[model samples]
Target: MITLDLTLPDTRYPIHIGHGLLDQVELILPHLRIPQVAIITNDVVAPLYLQRLTQQLEKHGVRTIPVVLPDGEEHKNWQTLNLIFDALLAANAERKTTLIALGGGVIGDMTGFAAACYQRGAPFIQIPTTLLAQVDSSVGGKTAINHPLGKNMIGAFYQPQLVVADMDLLATLPERELSAGIAEIIKYGLLGDIDFLGWLEANMDKLRARDPVALQYAVRRSCEMKAEIVGQDEKEQGVRALLNLGHTFGHAIEAGLGYGKWLHGEAVGAGMVLAAAASQAMGWLTADDVARVQALIAAAGLPIRSPDFGAAEWLRHMGHDKKVESGVIRFVLLQQLGQAVIQPGLPATLLESLFHSPHIDPALARQ
Candidate 1:
């Protein structure tokens, strides 16, 4: 097992990553403030992991209330969030009751938000089953439910008490789900770690094949990178925004297509390519750089180009992004490979030109 620490202004927590970690209840029990807990999972993940996890907790003498929500990004909204509240209130959970998020990013996000809002606040732990969550979403304190107009429009920055990432859970992930996670893993490289990007290019086949060593290194390193960034700028006051390198474009795509239509990581894969292409047009990145970025994303089995939502429609969705300040949408753009910056007030004409570019491949757009 490998352990990493995230020290922020208001809190400090450990991120534990390894195989079979979930079966060891001792690791989780110490983090809880009380013996009673509520677990928020999804229908799909419940069948696969809920029983075993519950058994482990009960063996440790921890009482649990399991709330199994419908699975998918579409379900990440006020309606589903209310279900967590309903279960928590019905169970008579108190402020000290820790919430255990036992699924992928969707579960982790909603559960964390619930913990943050319930009785003003409560502690929570993230047991992220998907690669995307373990490497990115689960580690960071950003928790949110999707709004109709934008992805993650409703949320909080509530940190988990501890993050228990059991890589063994990934063994059952669907192929597309696994591919979607690689998109976020690649974002770590694009945002700040050029060396990691090279490593990914070299060992992507091993990752895709689910080699244990490759998977472990990918998750460990991704967590370390995120922890460091979050520690430096916990509230996204500055450097932390770099973490959203592909998210702006990705969120726009998600909202334009409707949430859950395209997986978050899949949209990010295509979004990164668009960001790179835009950088190229601005003379910061070369055409070769753009091609390399697209190739790497494609290697992970993610789409390289997005459906052309057109400039006006694209702007409409992007304007709803949380990064927007005073109606000006801030974009996290690449100055070069592995270097990201937040730029706002970009001219609308440049966006229009990029949208009309032939490289976007209309044939590739999903209809």
Candidate 2:
């Protein structure tokens, strides 16, 4: 078990990471001071663990309601968010009602968004089920649905009361999701900590084997690193954007491909590879560094190659990226592992080569 503190300017919250954390939820939840509770999940995740969570809440005498949305990233939008409001209204859930995000990133984002908008903002708890959620989306209070125009554009930066990661539940996750989560784990190592990256390389096999001890350590370290950065820059005025190291490029791939065709982490995994290559091309990193990053990503079951989109279409996708300011596309580049820098003056020739390169093959990425 590992406890990490996320200290923001207004308040601080503890993010608990370990196996069998669901059992400890009731003792932990009441501290949020929520009068009512709503568990937001998806069709896929609800059946697997919802009953256990709901039972725990009921045993604690909490009024619990369940709202299960359709499974898939494509469903993460306003229509789905409306369903949550409908449930809250029907249950007469007030501002004190806490929303529990009971699934992966989608559930966490949607439920948190609903909590933010409920009566002009309520409290939320993150119970991230997937490895992707456990490490990335659960800790940050970035709640949003994908806009037709952009991803996470219409979201609020609302903080959650608590983040509970029940690592045991991840055992039932599909292999692809497990693989996807590794992408974010690797991102942490790539962007900030060379030591953690080295640790991941050493324990990659153990992680795939679902070794409880190894996963617990990985989750704990990742959260601690993120908490430190988020504490320093809660609203993304500076260092926080570094966390989106691969996301700027990844979001473009997701939006272009239409979300759900590729997993979020998978796209980011490939994006990191592309970004690394771009940095190398721009003389920010060595070719050997880019190769090393690729080798590690490929070992983790992530997509190391970009898709084979033409220059125009790729630009069409990347042009809509939210990180772009004044129509200039910006990217977070890895100068090396454990260090990331964002560059806004990326050359158009790089984009042209990126699209034209035969190396960009989605199939090649999908081990």
Candidate 3:
């Protein structure tokens, strides 16, 4: 088992990564604040791994309440969030009751948000099943649901008690979902680690083939990078914004496509390409660097080009982005490969040209 600690100013938690770690009760029991444990999952995930997790918790004499919601990003909203609250209320769960997020990014985000708001905050554990959740969403305490206007527009910075990432769970992931996870993994490399980017380039094939060692290292390195960044700036007051390298454009794509149509990771992959293109336009990145970024994303079987949403539509969706400050949208732009910076009030001409560019698929272009 490999363990990495995420130490923040107000809290700290350990992320445990290994095969079959879910069945190891001792690793989880220590983090429970109470005897009642609530497992929040989705329909897709409950049948796959929930029973085993419940059985493991039961072995430790803990009561389990399983709350399974519909599986999909479409359901990640206030309505679904209310289901968790309703379940907790019906179970007579107290603030001491520990909530366990037992699925992918949607489950982890909603469950963490539920924990944050339930009884003014209850502690929760993350048992991220999907590769996307295990490497990215599950580690950082940034929890939220999609607002009609934008993605993750509603949420909080609530930390988990512990993060249990069992690499074995990834074996069940759909091919598209696995590729989506690679998008976030690539974000870490793009944002600040050139060496890691090179490594990803060298091992892209192994990752796609589901090589065990590659999977473990990707998760570990992503977690380590997040831990270090979160420790430095817990609330995104500063350097943490760098972690959102492709997210602003990515979120816009999600909101534009109407959440669930394009998976978060797919949108991110394309968004990173867009961001790289934007960086090249601003003279920070060369054509070769942009090509490298696009090549890596495409090699991972992820989309590198966005749907052709018109400049007006793109502007409208981006207007709702969380990074907007004083009515100006702030973009995370590449200073170069492996380094990023926040660029606010990006020139309108550049933005419009990017939105109307031929890089976008013509079929998706506005009428």
Candidate 4:
């Protein structure tokens, strides 16, 4: 196992990346200094891996309580989160009882939120099953559930006690889901590391095939980059927003289509294309820059064109995004590869025209 330490202001945690790390769950949990455990998983994940995880906890002499939620972004809401709290309460789970998030981003975020709110707060470990979760969501302590008005509008900045990413679990991921994770990995390269992006472009096929070394490098590098960013801005006051490069438009897509219509990474992939294109149109980025980014995102098996949301609705959705402040929407646009700048005070109409522009082939847009 490769372990990296993440040093946030008031908290320190380790990110473990390896094959079969889940088998070492017992050794992993004790470090969190907890006496009891509550695992929040989903029906999809629990049926396949729950028995082994439950047994492992039992072996460690930790009393285990499981709350299995229905899996999907749509199910990431107060109702499901309430059930987790109710279950923990029924189990008499205490302030110090640790919560193990045993699924992807949705499960991790909801579990983290539950731990944050349960008895004011409790420690939690992230066991991210999907690529998006492992590389992006799980490591950063950004826990959230979807709001009726916006994606990730209701959430907390609650860090995990530990983050264990078992690459073996990704073997069972569906092809589409695997592709979605690749989008975030590509983001790590595009937003900060040109060398990593070059490496990804060269070895993407191996990553798609799930070769262990390639997966490890990608997973480890992505996690370390995020850890470094989070360490610098533990509460996302500034600098951390760099991580939201594609998220503004992505969140709008999620809200417009309804969450889960497009996987978060998928939307982010497309959103990156628009942000890049917008950067070009604004004359801040060259055409070659936009093309390079578009090519990389397309190579990752993610859609590179904006979906066919009406211009009016898209404007309205962006208005509801949490990043909007004082009625102005801010966007992270590319100044160049491995470079980004946050552009603020953009009129929604300017963005709408950019997405609707003729330079982009509307033929590629999703109906």
How much lDDT does candidate 1 score? 0.91
lDDT of 3 at 121: 95
**lDDT of residue 361 for candidate 3:** 74
Residue 291 shift from truth in candidate 2, angstroms: 1.5
lDDT of 2 at 311: 69
The residue ranges of model 4 lying beyond 4 angstroms of the native Cα positions read: 347-349, 358-367
1-367, model 1: which lDDT tens digit per residue? 9999999988999999999998988999988888999999999999999999999999889999999999999999999999999999999999999999999999999999999999999999999999999899998799999989889988999999999999999999998989899999999998888999999999999999999999999999999999999999988888988888888889988888878888999989988988888888777899999888989999999988787877888889888887899999888888999988888857777788878876465654465
Tens digit of per-residue lDDT, candidate 3, span 230-327: 88988898888888887888888888888888889998999999999999999999999999999999999999888887888888888998778899
The residue ranges of model 3 lying beyond 4 angstroms of the native Cα positions read: 365-367
* Candidate 2 ranges beyond 4 A from true positions: 362-367
Candidate 2 per-residue lDDT, tens place, 181-235, comes to 9899999999999999999989999988889899888888888888998999989
lDDT of each: 0.91, 0.85, 0.92, 0.85
Cα error, candidate 3, residue 230 (Å): 0.7
Candidate 1: where is the Cα deviation over 4 Å? 359-366
Taking the candidates one at a time, how many backbone clashes does each contain? 0, 0, 0, 0
Q: Model 1 TM-score?
A: 0.98
Clashing pairs in 4: none
TM-score of each candidate? Answer: 0.98, 0.96, 0.98, 0.95
